[model samples]
Target: MCSTLPTEVQNAPQIDQDSGDTIGVLDCLRLNVYVPNKASSQNPLPVMVWIYGGGFFEGAAGWYDGSYLVKHDVVVVTINYRVGPYGFMCLDIPEVPAFGGDANSITVFGQSAGAGSIDLHLYSPYERLFHKAIVQSGSAKVEGMFINPDYSAAINIAQQLGFNTTDSNEAISFLSTIDSHLVIAASSSLGYWFRPCKEQVFDNVANFVEQDSQNQYSPARIRNTPLFVGTTSDEEYTYDMNEFAGNPFLDKIKTHYSLSDADLTRISNTIRHFYIGDEEISSDLLRELNDFKQDFHFQHPIDRAIVKYIEQGANVYQYIFAYSSDDSPVYHSAELKYLLSPKFDPLDESNKKDLLMSKCATTMWTNFAKYGNPTPESTEEVPVTLDRATVDKRSYLYVDDENGNLLPLTSLPRKYQNWGQDRDWNRGSGVGPDDGVRIDFDNRTVVGIRIDSENG
Candidate 1:
């Protein structure tokens, strides 16, 4: 009954488990609060806020349920924020007030695009908003989400609605004056993406993004609270092998980092060589293709954020979710089946082991919310103690490789460069957690972005 931003209400590829109605609204900024029965005014429970991930274009609060998590004796808050253009316009607008909660014990967590947003908070001055953050398979830079206002989307989208102008201010003005629905329709028609653009920060700028995490990575500016990072063994564990032939995401990356033409070609060759070596890109190289997609889309960006987190002196707890129902490969966002449970889980049929994993993930997450550490003490469900990943040794907890047994935290080989077989997720290896999370194809093709301000 409230208002959401001017985005299509449905999530991209759809959250199959979310049986809620999908309708776009404008004024419904809501906080779906789930408080444990034990919580009272006198007794404030540790708060964990859920941020849905839909590539900054899709997602809704109505699709998620926090009741399963509240059973763990924590206050769960599912938030709704302005997305697409409304969310990231960053044009000197009044700041929207977030839900008021126990600030000291707040832990923000999300997956994919949601995880990317959580990672962004670490760079802002408002790092104090949450005492801790759990980033799942994403960071601010994931999927080339952040950029300067280099694209002509304002003019192009306006032109779609019968307004043609090259002036940025004028185009924006025309866009602002038109019916919001008209703008949305036009944007949808031309595949315009209104993403978070890196801004030039100055004195008295209200809610402006100053620098990118890559160019302006300042460890001193971030709040080094206890951080938990989760990654599925493969981003998109299973896919049509031929879909990724010669489709390197470097085109998007070329624009994201503003690479030159010469540099682009050189980097592309190097990357393509690494992924497929001298072999031509085709259906035959499914494993290499998956690796390339996984690295470019998820792990590399997350790895960048991890390096930044470590540099900031944050107590970082990294996890690789490898549990599969039949001991097969687990796909991207696979842990969500365990983390959200019952509802919000696409896999309707859950085995006893799945339920156990649900307990393990929920307990671990809620434990981190209550106390910075995930495994302060071993429980029946989670018998293994998790160790923090450090600068010298990048050790992280491997979650439930065995269907029933919680695997102890183990040290991964110093770098991913050391691994020869990156695609085999189920392979038992001393280096890495078999495989890290994979990337999605929809993220690249569905969401269209300008490669450069001039040509693309």
Candidate 2:
């Protein structure tokens, strides 16, 4: 069903130059379209737009190959947006171009920072540009995910480049002159430097913590958009943390949140008790620490988003990619290898399970893109039906080595009890652990329930 293009025809123009327009040139914004052989006006297939993630520092459309999804009778469009300080410096540049053609069936899928980008688009005035979204291993609610509009990091990057200017206009002019590679290198070093922000033009999009505080932000804003969000079993294992040995990591966390020594002790002890369970710090404590980081950064935020979306009467599907290979466990971005890997081999014995998982994932994803629901119908390869998440069952897809199945959200490893409601351990507040009424963590209940009851 797949046809290979001739070598000469395979070569497409690369967007390497900066436009130098009001949009701050560095115009690496382009779309790579993969259309099925049978696609035409008579048989226009659904389109899936991919947004790649590199922590807002680096990402490209060329990194992902959408040929696999194209083979499933869908048009796959991978797009490039300005990363680092260029695309998200809160400059008055032209907004990223919206996808053209069949807006009603467009599904935008992204991973990590790319997923976070999708989250921004969901709340932006241009949210109607797409009909569905799939957010993997990232959320708009994660603290520090979005940069502030003041563009402090941009100024810092400019200073490092010898510009020595804080004026926005002067900085932009100087930044426009620097080589793109040099600017990206300097911004990368600044880590958490350039990212999406709440600016005057689009102030509606706020981080989850801000949304919770204002009571004004609501999933109802994007209620018409169906969402599929999920995370890996070990989202943070991919990062090297050997540098965080001893108390340095704790110190870093305290500084990041502006927590006092006493607050840090309470929060660290709470995390330790939950993940390490009274075990003293040792070599084995690394895994527990990694899990804590994963939950705090990725999973907990996702859980909150899912709950909020469901409460808004939106169709949401959740998943936990627990599939592991002999060589690697389900680390962050591992599922991408199954979903978008160009070298995927289904014939090899070792790849049998991977192939199954990949097929299930691609099918479900493409199915969601084609139809609003993932399990609209079942086929021989995919017999089981995945269910949508609801307030009652909280059903979600559990993708494993065998095949995908609908499982209760509670069955997933790790619990997000008291997530945002716990003012002490949450990312937004600095209350001590002893300040709030004790919660029954064993019951796996959210602390919001108690607050809701008390207010009622």
Candidate 3:
């Protein structure tokens, strides 16, 4: 594994698919290897396989540089996957061929849409390749799943473009004949949102759907691998493009959703309830739009998955990025520029808080990559434990300007106790997946976190 990595500064390894095929082998698949210098006594360093997300419609590994992790005693690998109709929609069909072959010890990491891919990949037949994972601003819940709401809208748009969505593969084959970028542009112009869909049960290709009767996503259950997951405090803000006086996609959104003002308001409130939590939101169309963004794009899915993982005894840690500034609104993709590059100076130069926060964030992440735990040193005060341990509820490390702080795992929100359990599951009172756990924040210390197994 180490030998295949790029070692010298001037000798970057070429991109290759796991099948030993070159980058060009699959038009949609791409991979890059980052080998750390093995001048030290130990070689064959740990590896991180990154997946980029563009709502599964657009994004490439080349978009995110891995030199950050590579410079810090780890090897980073990134890949390019098919996007839009050419990629996701095409892959769902039975006749479509699978790309990457078997690979091992891979750790999946991605943000946004890429993170969704990680969640889907975990259920894929090829999932065992990665030992663990890190997902940012993405979740494994169907609510978080990136599905195109407007199937008819897509079909109608295709008709306008002189293609047929009812016969999608035929349309795809015709469209594939054209340049990919051109096809994407043409599809978007007519309000056809390209992303992963509910793969049919028979084919089961890319089985990201909730019901996998064959147990495709339940790969014998690797319960030991650690998971680090979280989202920003103001993630919805990025969707608030109009708050910045930028063009609001209200018309475009109307075209896609076709909702009444009252319906839009209800949908907007639902988004606010999930993403912003109990936090107060400013009264504005932008805030409503932000809510819409979080509802369809981010919150519920991640929330559900985290809840399920915690209930299932998987080692899980969670955080909420609360830091924001004029230059950075704690929005989507802000963490990237920090995680991948230290030299990136925010518009208003990064303050001491920013620098300290960046360092703290990166340190915790690297520590996890090296040892699968984020704590800096071993201690009973904050032991690095997983799913079965209540200690984790009180053992979380909050990365902030104050050089970082560790909070008791028990201090997390009480809502977590009941995070992912379905209403039906919660019908009876017990401490398991079947039991619906509810967080009583006012009376309980873990407001939105830490499962209250007793009442739940």
Candidate 2 local lDDT, 1-456, one digit each (tens): 643231211112112224422222365566677767776665566788898877775556666777767767777877777765666666542212232235457889999998877777766544266789999988776656764466466577788888897676777778778886677667655654566666544455433223321122456676766888888887777345564467643554464455456545655555456566666766667776776677667776677666667767778877888777674657778778767773322223367766776677788789889887777777755566667876555677776655345343433342543344343344322211343332222222223122222111
Report lDDT (Cα) of residue 62, candidate 2.
63
- Local distance difference test values of all predictions, in order: 0.63, 0.62, 0.50
Better by TM-score, candidate 3 or 2? 2
- Residue 188 lDDT in model 3? 54
As for candidate 1, its clashing pairs are: 2-28, 3-27, 3-28, 4-25, 233-436, 234-438, 235-437, 235-438
lDDT tens digits by residue: candidate 1, 1-456: 112222223322221234432235456476667666566556667888888777776676656766666778887777777666546544422211232236568889988888878776767665356788888887776656675564567777777888878876788888777765565556656765666767645567544356664544656755467899867777765468545534464654464444456545554554555556677666677776777667656665666567567767888988878888777676777887776642345434347666667777889999999889888898896787877876556777777555467666555522342221122331111112212211212232211111111211
RMSD of 2: 7.0
**For candidate 3, lDDT tens digit of each residue in 1-456?**
222333222211222223332122135354767665552223345567777766655455555656655655666776666655456542334500011211333467888887776776665554366777888888545332455334344345456567766765565466556544455556556545566655554543444454431122352563666777777655666543445332223333233344556544443333234444454544444555564455334454465565555555567767656554444456776677656641233322246655555555555566667677666474433333332233334234343322244343434444333333334433111112222223221122111222233432
The window of 10 residues in a row where model 2 has the poorest summed lDDT is 6-15
Residue 75 in candidate 2, Cα distance off native in Å: 0.8
What number of clashing residue pairs does each candidate have, in the order they appear? 8, 2, 21
The TM-score, computed over Cα atoms with residue i paired to residue i, of candidate 1 is: 0.78
